[model samples]
Target: MNVTLPPTRSLLVAGALGLAVLAAAAGGWYWYDAQQRRVAAAYAEVMTRVYAVQSPQAPADARARAQQELEQILARHPSATPVGEAAFELGNLRYAARQWAPARAAYEIALARAHSPTVRALARTSIGYAWEAERDWGKAIEAYQAVGREVGPKDFLFDEVQFALARVQELGGQPAAAITTYQRLLKDAPNSVRVEEAKQQLMRLGARAQK
Candidate 1:
């Protein structure tokens, strides 16, 4: 009986193929990481410009430049990790300019792009504020209500959303709803920073929280 041996050339080909696959995977990861780093650097640069506009002595063109750069980031890297944050900054610039329609549009983009719950919540709340700025109480209430429904009570922004909802309801000629919302805030977020404010609002509304 003769013993047959497996071909060594076939074994070498298989090993080379495995190494190639691993090299390809590593190259792909390196490319992704490099792209992310570039996105982060761009985001940081835009944020610096954004924050610079907060100074009372900021240059008149500071906000415009910041807004322009942020828009460029959105246009250039629409699917990047920082796209949502850039959109939020753009929304803030528009909001400060009292461009309510444009502000809400930017915030809508933030909401669509952001993966973080906090960012999404902030964008949603800002949308409500933009409506409030426009004196569109009904739409403001709807936006705030959407936040309440989507975010949990344990979320850090939940109390703020509740307060906004209550305030909008009151201004929208729905005192009963406002009172109920205040009571809900009082119940759901007893230790929130807004708790005292909620109590004051309840008092002014001639309502008390249920035990």
Candidate 2:
């Protein structure tokens, strides 16, 4: 004899399957949520340590603690977003100490982990500053130029990157290029903070600033 489940039994089976699926989805979401929270927490902790090192009023111990914490972040979260942040902070600390080479290395790490062009441009600029600190003018110009070449015109960093690139060109023995860059910036962004500096630099370079 053939047997079939009643309508009630069939409905119960379907409902159970639906509830199981819902539970599974809930569990998966919870796991993702927890992972995101962990990443956020790590970023926050790293920022705290970095700020401590950045603060001039912070004691020597604060610097030491910050270094230790940064190392831990790098060691543990090798691929997390905050690893880039930690590296960036470490670069700032080293730059403050005038340790040019190490600062460049840290900035490079930051560049590797940067998720956006804005962050990449900023890291490149910092690398240029490190090169300038070391008196490596050619590399400084290269770094700054890379930012201009890679970043979009719509980016907020565009003008600042150009200003930095121009400064590096001047320092790299390309005074004429630097003057041209400054003039362009003046014409394009009259309201920029760099405008006054550009005018001053143009005057120093014996170039007439446009009215």
Candidate 3:
């Protein structure tokens, strides 16, 4: 299967003041904006490295290069608009490295920097997964619960987050809570792909879901 990678993020400041009159009046501003775009261009290199690391054709050095590039982007663009993306990428890299604690930390940074609800929720999901990987069930539950509070049922990631929340509950030694979560998904998102998954989990737990 062909895998797709995240596209490059652009500098949010409008394109260079190409007009001569505006440029002359705002020479310093234009120079700063140009520098900003130059810095933002580093995200493209990070994207390339990310794709390489995630690809089946990935080299042995791909991960090392990706980690370095992501760190560079963070260092070089501390106030860059795509700092959130860089942090999220770092979280993904740490998760892939199996450094769950650092992964959660990076995701927390991403969440703090994220302006969009979807981005924040996605960061929370990653945080939950990182906690789950560490077998820190209570923390995972808290992170996943934050997702539920952040996003609505119809949100693009709602079903996925709910399913993960239930699994965290189950693995966290709270089968009853897991069962309730599963039932809620079944009732609220009956047409969701996770519906059958929830049912299967309920059955495995030897509990009947309240349909």
Task: Please report the candidate that would top lDDT against the real structure.
Answer: 1
Steric clash count of candidate 2: 0
- CA error at residue 167 for candidate 2, angstroms: 2.7
Give the TM-score of each candidate: 0.78, 0.73, 0.81
Best-first order by TM-score: 3, 1, 2
Error of 1 at 84 (Å): 0.8
Positional deviation of 191 in candidate 2, in angstroms? 2.8
CA-only RMSD, every prediction: 4.4, 5.0, 15.1
Worst 10 residues of 1 by lDDT: 202-211
Q: What pairs collide in candidate 2?
A: none
What is the Cα-based TM-score of model 1?
A: 0.78
Worst-scoring 10-residue span by lDDT in model 2: 202-211
Off by over 4 Å in 1: 1-36, 207-211
**Model 3 TM-score (2 dp):** 0.81
Residue 189 CA displacement from its true place in model 1, Å: 2.3
Candidate 1's residue-wise lDDT over 82-185, tens digit each? 88878888999989878999999999999999888788889999999999999999999999999999887788878888888988898899988998998998
lDDT of 1 at 158: 88
Of the candidates shown, which would achieve the greatest TM-score relative to the real structure? 3
Off by over 4 Å in 3: 1-25, 207-211
What does the lDDT come to for candidate 1? 0.88
- Select the stronger candidate by TM-score from 1 and 2: 1
lDDT of 3 by residue, 94-204 (tens): 788888988888888899997766677789899999989988889889988988887777888888888888888887788899889889888888888777878888897
